[model samples]
Structure formats: structure tokens, C-alpha cells
Target: MKHQSTGESLSTYSPLLLFICFLISLPISAQDEPKISVGGALRFNYNLSSWKEGQKNRGGDFGYDMFRVNFNARFKGVYLNAEYRLYSDAFGGGVLKQGWMGYKFSDIDEIQIGLTQVPFGIQQYNSHNWFFNLTYYVGLEDDHDMGLKYIHAGEKFEYHLAFFKGAEELNFGSETESSTSRYSYDVVGRNKEINQFNGKFVYKFGDKAANRLGVSAQYGSLYNLDTKENGDHYGLAAHYEFSQDRWNVKAQALTASHNPKNAAGENRDVLKFGAYGAPYQVAADFNLYSLAVSRNIPVNLGPVSNLEFYNDFGYMQKQKSQFTDSYMNVTGVLVTAGQVYTYIDYAAGYNHSWLGGNFKDDFAAGNPDAKWEARFNINIGYYF
Candidate 1:
């Protein structure tokens, strides 16, 4: 499948099912006891696209995007954090984005076990726009997996180290689960990610400017079910953020390589990554970079209190001579009013997934005459 947006059937689990079930509990009243709170959001989306001629001609669709539940609890040194999402059945129904239980060792140290965000690249996000940067499409940004994570924060530095056993499998059936229908991209169809190690260190400098610089590195094993052997992949990144007053700027440079021991007669130059009910191919070796800038402005329009104007750009350069490069540009504004937030973006992509590329060759095979695709989108949500 070329770049697409959708989801499919989810699998059943055994123990983790029970654990997540335990995590999904009733929202109790807020009191002065051990801290516990439950909150969530209701989101809707509307989009007009240049790629979807039929949809654009007939007018874009406006509908419910998702409903989520977030739960957090803490007692003494033990704490729990989890989020579950419910999407339209066409988008794979319900899935757990993240759920983890952890213990605090000290004021600056803690450990988290279960599904957690990988310690790679920028901490929370790499872009100001909702679509994020190009790194996100290939599982480099905001990616999460089943792992044990250690975090430490000092006066001038922050450290994150993690060891992931593999991707989270929630199926109880006998069939090998399709890696599609997930929130983050991962090796699928005969390969799975496993035995990964990640480390990231950030230094805070220029107290007057609130600047941060960080480096991230990760190496992991890719296990092929058919081959019964391990391939390997690694990623390295350097990122920076500079913030002052109402302005924030971010920049990142990263490179990644994946060598999968696919079954005989399979191509090694391209690998399939599946997520959100679709699979797309990407060059096995490539470098990516992104830059984003935003300015937060206080506004007074009815209940609206804040507005942010931003532009985010990303480019991917493939190492192979036969493959084509990809680039994306998003110019957007965000509006916040009370508990409501909205994003309006004009996103353009060339030889990119989720933009207009066919599933097989968008990021792998070259297309010198690749046409640019654009999408105008608006997403609004109410958080409680």
C-alpha cells in the first residue's frame, strides 16, 4: 500500500490485556488524597485535498476523528499513566496509545516499564504542526514500543536510556498480526523490531535564551519470522531548541539505516513500514532534517485566549541512487480558547506518504517528475 490513512482489525492480548484493563478504571472525584485524575478529548476533522479529486470535487468530509481517555494516578512513590483511544471502526476501532506503571526513586530519577515513548530524537515533538515532521512517518519521532525506560534530570542535563524487547503485540489469535493499524510505524509483514537500545542526553545552555541541545542514538535487531534470523537497524540524531518570550524554534538532523534479512528474492533496498491500517515502502538508508518556528500570541476573541502561527518544513534524502527524495511543508495556525483547541494547516508534500504517493514507491523508488500534493485541514478538540 502506498501512503494512505486508515486502520484495520486489532488483535486480542493475554496478560497485557489484563494490565491495560486494570489501568482503565473509573474516574473518581478529585480530593486531597493520593493524586488521581481522569481527562480526555473529543476531536473532529475536516479536510480538502488536491490528491483526492473525487472528494475535493464533492466537498470535503467533516466528521468525528477520535475520542480518548487519559488516566493518571499516584500514591507515594508508585504511579501510573495511560491513554486509550476510540476511533471509528474504519480506523481500527480502539487501541491503547500508551500505558505504563512506574516508581520514583528520587527527585530526579525514575523508571517506567510497559509501553513507553522511545528515547530518541526530540523529547515530545519535532514540529509545531499536527502532521509533525518527515521523521515521524518512518517511526523516528513520537514512536513508542514495549520497553523499560530510565530517566534522570540534573540541574543542567537530562538523560534517557531505554531497552525495548520488541514491539507490543496485542493479539490472541494464532495468525501473525499485521503491524498495520498501529499508531507508530514499524517493520511488518514478516519482520518485527526487537532488542533495541536507546540513549539520549540533553544539555541546557544559555539561561537567558532557554536553549537546549541533544543527541540521540539507537540500535536494534529486526527479526524476520520466515528467516528466523536477525537483521539490524540504527538511528542517530542531533536536535536543538531555542525559545524566548513568545517565540520557539526547533531544528533536527537525523540518519537511519535498516538492514533486514528478508526471505530470499526480496529486495533489501526498501523496507515496508505499516501503521494506521496501511503499509508504505521507504529507502533502507536515508537522512532527514527538519526546521520549525512558532510565535505564541495572546489574543482576545470571545473565549479565544491564544493563537500560534508557525511553519514547519522537512526533507528526506535517500542514499540509494535509484530512489527519490521527499519533502513536506506545513504552514498553520493554532487557536486556543478555554478548553478548546483548533489547528488550521495547509500541508504540501512531494513524493510523500499521507500526501499523494502510491504505497509501493513514494519513498523508495525515484520519481523525478513527482507532482506536489496539498491538503487543507482543520482539527478541533475539546479537552476536559
Candidate 2:
């Protein structure tokens, strides 16, 4: 599941970069000044996971996590939002998290085009801890791609429709860029994901529209560089969120199938998914389930305003016969201060790429595991 590496790689950011430049070069009347906002964060991480033998034997390890830059501009009803991040080389290095120029037709209607978040599962996130559920690893959660999105927020409901040409590509078609350096997971190697369509609908009820029930559907075509034949993917998800006073509950059930026209002798049931500077295998078809609940506990500790305690669970059932299912659970608390936030999590999983098993093969044709692996992690960041 490895793509050939090329000595030279090209970037596809020229168009977007040019667009930003155009906005910056636009003449602004003396009477009207543009509103620009700039901010970002610095973060650090410490982890002690049982799966890392050396770390477990030596207590744990701590290191720098990331530094990010945020840029936003507003002129009348038009605006731009962009965030770029720098992580250790061991991670994904420097990458753009999201960059989109948008127009707000009204308070509840808008359109965005660029590398934008795909509307699926939940609105912001389904997990409160640092380590998200299994869905995140499979690219079903918090996934962003190069696309155009339209959002409409009506009084009784809200919906999102998007069409993505492909994943954020760092290398143009001129070269064989093999590095899986990115912020979101997508098909890599000899296969390319293209022509994606997404639609999400949500109905709200209760005071302030605090309760929501939603469903999402997606269809996309996969182009195989080797086979030169077209393949496709389809997905569906049902999600619910309930909020009351200081309590919140979120749940989702999703199923997806991917068929790639790989080269002869290659496994069609497994495809390579890459992100965060690494690549892993995922079963071609699977059903996923996730549930999470949280409670806000007001705290008066010095420099700490409040605390949120929550637990999240994810289960992935492989459709291929005899393939074992994957499971994950996270119990953690989020601490929020004025401009700093921390995530303290105790996470465990079986056949999970990040939680325990082999990084490359755990999600595809996984072997019978001895036991569940656990990890204790703390991630704190300062925001401006």
C-alpha cells in the first residue's frame, strides 16, 4: 500500500494563495476599514502508553506538540479564515488545517470554498478528550477536503451540502509524491479519492434548539492511478445530540464501504489511508458506532474556571468475514481557564491504530489481540 516516492513534489496552493493576495490588494476606502483578526496557539503533550514498551518501562515521555497561526479577515459580508500548523517532523510537520474564503448572505446562510471541513457525524466534535474515537482515524470525523460548501440555518432546521474535488493535495500530478503528510486522512498510494458529494440534514427541537437529530449521506468516486478504472464509495450516518442544563449526550451510527480499483494482486478489501505523516490500512467495508456523554462541573480553582468530565466509546465492525472488530474507550476531563485549556485522558482500545496495535495493519485484517491496551495522556495549549 505504498506509493512511489518522487524526488520532487509540487503544491496546489497557488490558486488559493493567489485569491488571498487579491483580497489583500483590494482598495479599501478611508471611510471603511477591513476587520482583520490574527491569533493562534502553542501546545505541549505528555503521554504514557502501555503499548510503547520503552516509554512504559521508563515512566513516560513529554515533548513539544505544536505551534499554529490563525489569520482571518472580514470586509462587509465577505471573509476569509485560515489556520496553519507546525508540528514535529515525527508528526506531520507544517500543514494548513483549513483555509476558506466565504460569503455570508445573511446571519444564517453562507457559502465557503477551499479546504473546508466536511459536515458529518457531529457539528464540532463528538469526543471531549484529546484522543478522538475510532471514527476520527477512519476519516469519518473531522475530515476536511478541497471543496465548496453551502450552509443554511433555518429556524426549525439546518443543512449542509458540499462537493469536494479531492483531498488537500500537496503534490500536483507532475510527480509521485509519496509522503503522507497531512491533517486529514485520505486514500493514498496508487489510488486517489475524487469527486466527492456530501449532504447533511438536522432537525432541532426544544429551547434554544438544544436538541438535534440528524442524518448524513455521502458518495464519491475513486480514481486508480494504476488501474485507470473508476471506483466509488458510499456512506450513511445517523446522529443525535441532547443537551440539558449542564449535561450533554452525543451518539452516532455510521456505515461506509470503499472499493478501489487497485493493481492486480493488490488487496481490494484493504486500502491505504494516510495522515499525520503516516499511513495505515482500513477495511474496505465496516459499520461504526460511537457514544459520548459529558457533564460540566463549575470549578473555582485558581486559574481554572470550569471542568468537563466525559466518556466516549467507539466500535468498528468489519464487514469482511472473520475480521475482528475494533473498539475504543476514552474517559477524560477538560479543564478550561482564561486562555488555556487542557485535556487529561485515560484511553484504551483494541485493534486501534493510535491506542495500541500495529500502526499499519490494525485496522485491516487485524489479528487476535492479547488484551486491551491503555494510555494516559495530557495535552495543554495556550490560546491568544
Candidate 3:
């Protein structure tokens, strides 16, 4: 131990050891820089209605109270985005709304994988960062499904494609068959399985009056059913936005067809008695259409920046062989006439139907061939 080793001497050098520690800590300090952000919104609504169907209530009531959370992160060329939503008596008994991950390829193309909203309509593709009337008019029921999607966006053009699980309904087995089975079946097992494919394209005009146009198509199949009974649907939509001002116009149309196996004669009596039986087959075709116009106004307040006023109307028709021709005609309006700090949205609507009355047996009882429903909704949302 007359001469200390070089390693031992270096470890004992206080100044040198301090310098090394500083060098190692520098990179971590840089790497720890903030690279993520978080944001979200909460929405609540109240509805008052007097209808000819079901139950009638006089006082106002909470309609849909929703809470949403979002996260965004990025580093270099990689990015991640996700959202989760909670609904109280809304969104069908509070189910997982949306969860997905995306990858960017250059600035033109991207791919997303997970349980995401299907990009088949203008409303489904709009950014959810703001609270607006787009969600109400664009229609939200059929756009959410489990699948993967590809997107390509350019200066004047954009495209999207998606694949998803199709609509399914529970099918129960007969009492005789259920007795022999070792276990009872739930809704999931009885559901018929299907798959869907969809595509969309958009183009923007570069004229003095800025405007954009879009078109879309879709095809789907039910694997377990025959060709005629399997499900298929298609749709088309368009929009025009004025560049100089805050005005826009949009329209959309969609149709679907299905043919289920005809088990009417064999299962009619058993199904009527509430016993498990094959579903009665019905050949049906459904169609829907919507149109609207909207304008945004400038306001003077803390980011109380914009206000919007809009009116929307839609119609749906379904024809089936099992019953008299069925159709639903509905018209609704939305008005946001005040500043963001103080806003009012009044929605009033009416629906008329044929083939089925407001009550389940209203039509079957031969009481009347037509039924009507009237509703009114008002909501005020604000952020500070």
C-alpha cells in the first residue's frame, strides 16, 4: 500500500469526482424537458318534454351530463393522442367511449390503431377540442367501432379508410335446446358477428371564396348470414365553408339493407310466449338525410370570442315486409345567440311516424296509423 492505485487516487480526488457528476447529470436535465399537455371538457344538459308515447313528464330534467379527458405527447417525430369520456345516463349506460394511438409518417400520412371513431362522416372527423353544434348535426351513433384506420392529408385534399366490427343483436336458443346445453348464453354469445370497410375523400377550393367538398363510400358484410340476409350500407356527404366569413353549409345521406333468415312460421308461437326461439326474419331497407346552415359571430369578452347560430333538419325512412311501410320524419333546430360567457341554445323538435305508433301497441291496437312526439332542449356551456 506504499503507492496507491490510479483508480483509488481518482476516487479520492474530490474536484475530479464533482466534475464527473456534473457531466452525467447534464443529459438527464435536458431529457426531462416537458413534452406533454393535458386538457378536457365537461357538458351538462336539461330537457323538458310532453310526448304521445311512453311516459309523459311535466317538469324539466337533466338530459346528458358528460365528462371527458384528453392527453397529448410528442418528442422528435413521434406523437401520441388519446381521450376518455364518462356519461351519466347518456351514451348507453356509460361505456368506454374512445381510446386509440396514432403514428405519423412525414406530414402527409398517418395510421391509427385501437377502438376509435370510424371516419365515415364530416361530424365524426371534426376535432373534439371545442364544444360546438357539429356533434349534434353530424350524427354520432354509427361512427364509433373497434378497428384500424389510415389517413392522408394534403394542402387541399384528405383521405381516410377504416375497418370495424359491424352491428350485432342477441339471438336466443329454444327452451328444448337450452335444457341440453351445459351453460346458459349471454347477449354477447347470441350476437351475430359482422365486419365493415369504409373510405372517404375531401377537396378544398383555392378561390377567393374559400370552400371545401367531400365524398365517402362504405361496404360491410355479416359472415354468419346468407348473402341476402347479410348487412350492407353506403353514404354520401358534402360541405361548403366561406373563407372570408363565418358561414357554412352541409348535407349528408345514408342507406342500409338487411335480410335475416325467415323463421317466422317455426318460431312465431314460441317467441310470443317469451320462450327462447329463433328471431323472425325481416327484409328491410333504411335511409336518412340531413342538411344545415350555420354562422359564427364575433364577441367582446375574455376569449368569449365566438358565437354560432344554426338550424338542422333530418328525415329517416325504413321499409319492411313484416309490417306496414314504416317511416320517421323529424326536424330540429339549434340556436347559440349569445356570447361565450353567456350563451343559450334552444332546441325544439317534432317526430311523426307511420307503421308503428308512439306506444308499442298504439298501431297494433288499431287505435291509429300515425303517432307524433314533441321535445324541447336547452343547454348553456361556458369555460373560463
lDDT, candidate 1, equals 0.84
TM-score of 1: 0.89
lDDT of 1 by residue, 86-187 (tens): 888777678788888877667888778788999898768889887888888888888889977889977789999888867766642333645577777777
What digit string (tens of lDDT, one per residue) describes model 3 on residues 36-153?
8876656667555554233334376765455667777755444566665555432332333455656666589976655666676564523211222222222223345555678998
List where candidate 1 sits over 4 angstroms from the true fold: 1-34, 172-178
Q: Which has the higher TM-score value, candidate number 2 or candidate number 3?
A: 2
Give the best candidate by lDDT. Answer: 2
Model 3 spans with C-alpha error above 4 angstroms: 1-34, 52-58, 62-64, 89-91, 125-142, 165-193, 223-244, 260-283, 301-304, 319-372, 382-384
Worst 10 residues of 3 by lDDT: 178-187
For candidate 2, the 10 contiguous residues with the lowest summed lDDT are: 6-15
Off by over 4 Å in 2: 1-31, 174-179
Query: What CA root-mean-square deviation does each model show from the true structure?
Result: 6.8, 4.7, 16.0
What's the TM-score of each model vs. the native?
0.89, 0.91, 0.62
| Candidates' C-alpha lDDT | 0.84, 0.86, 0.43
Best TM-score among the predictions, by candidate number: 2
How far off is residue 253 in model 3, in Å? 2.7
